[model samples]
Target: MTELPFATTRKLGLVIDLDTCVGCHACVVSCKGWNTENYGVPLSDQDPFGATPSGTFLNRVHSYEVQPDHGAAQLIHFPKSCLHCEDAPCVTVCPTGASYKRAEDGIVLVNEEACIGCSLCAWACPYGARELDQAAGVMKKCTLCVDRIYNENLPEEDRVPACVRTCPSGARHFGDLGDAESDVSVLVAKRGGFDLMPEQGTKPVNKYLPPRLKDVAPQIDILAPFLEPVSKGPKGFLGWLDRALSALPGEDR
Candidate 1:
């Protein structure tokens, strides 16, 4: 049997910092814009301007409110995308061999020409990464901006993936995960990075470093002023209306 090509273990992946991510959807929008034009079929929207507009997207950012202390909440924004696993379940489950990890860079990609429109690969992915392009009748997911990265026409600094390039908060970093000395590797080491849904044993290459929290107590007096009642001024019509509304009940008013 031929040995699995360890020669091509470059493991190109992303390291997303949870601390710096400011819940901006720039990465999501940038991804949609780039993939829509370059990917096999555009990420089509059904009635884009109408009610209940929906479209296919390879990456999505989720905002979660985490309350670590009493009356204190931190908004955590997670940019969810393909992890590009070393032991990718999606690749193994593909009947057509369309979903394969690139030998050159270890990036998993769907060969649109070879794909049989089977959704098995999508089902195998634990991260919910694969999206079916209804228009093309094939599966699509993040290519890590393969074409853009390799394009010589683009500037050297601008050659990274769209999501990483467009992140205003500097939350996303793309580099060779296989290189132990890489910046991403160092960041992962220093920050105690973790992979999402590791219990599935997919061995995801990408990592998410949790937000670091300081133990300092928040100043309570800052909130006290907002809680105090405002003294009523000379009663104009609007002021009378406000007083009447405020009198009608809830403590918040």
Candidate 2:
């Protein structure tokens, strides 16, 4: 079985804003495209064109219609991936030492070469973040796009995770959560970001910003005065036409 490090030098994770996500699945598509092409193995599909198509994906979005106590129902788009917990149960449960967390940066990853296709990690994960690749017969989860973020060939701006880069609504943010002054940390502090399922004690690195409640009836209502009319009557070409029409017989002045 694998053992987690006592501490990591940095905690790199995502801060997702629930209020801005539009459930467009751009993140999902980008993740699939990047991971399949560059990562360990291509994510496979079974019966893609058939009635029941199933495939491996590293990121997925779930939408829930939630009704606040005082407001109308709202649809929340939730994107789910590996949380890379500080005390990752998936790591401790791995029998072959394939699943491990990085000591330099707290990113959980699976060593595909060492993996024996055991489903233990998937079972241990509470977030349902792991998926067994049907073609490869190995468990796969999100790596936080480690290859892209640290690659020197890619442009600086493109160093973020594919999901973060492709998010149309700017809902996904990636940074060092460990740093108190980091942008992600500041956003989390300002938005009251929270862990998913805190009771699990996994100490997930990723934080989610809660959706701000929609405004109900206004407590005070004040109407603005109507704007004065711009002109009392037509004053240009329309004025000349009006004068000509008024001079004609039987024309109302």
Assess candidate 1 and give its TM-score to the true structure: 0.83
Best by lDDT: 2
Question: Which structure among the candidates has the greatest TM-score?
Answer: 2
Estimated TM-score per prediction?
Answer: 0.83, 0.85
lDDT digits (tens) for residues 1-253 of candidate 1: 1112454658899999999999788998999999898867788776789988777889988999898756568788999999988888888888877888887788889888898888998898999999887777889899999978889999999899999999998999999988999999999999999989889998888999999975777676877766757654746898888778888868852
lDDT against the true structure, each candidate: 0.86, 0.93
lDDT of 1 at 100: 87
Encode model 2's per-residue lDDT on 86-105: one tens digit a residue. 98999999999999999999
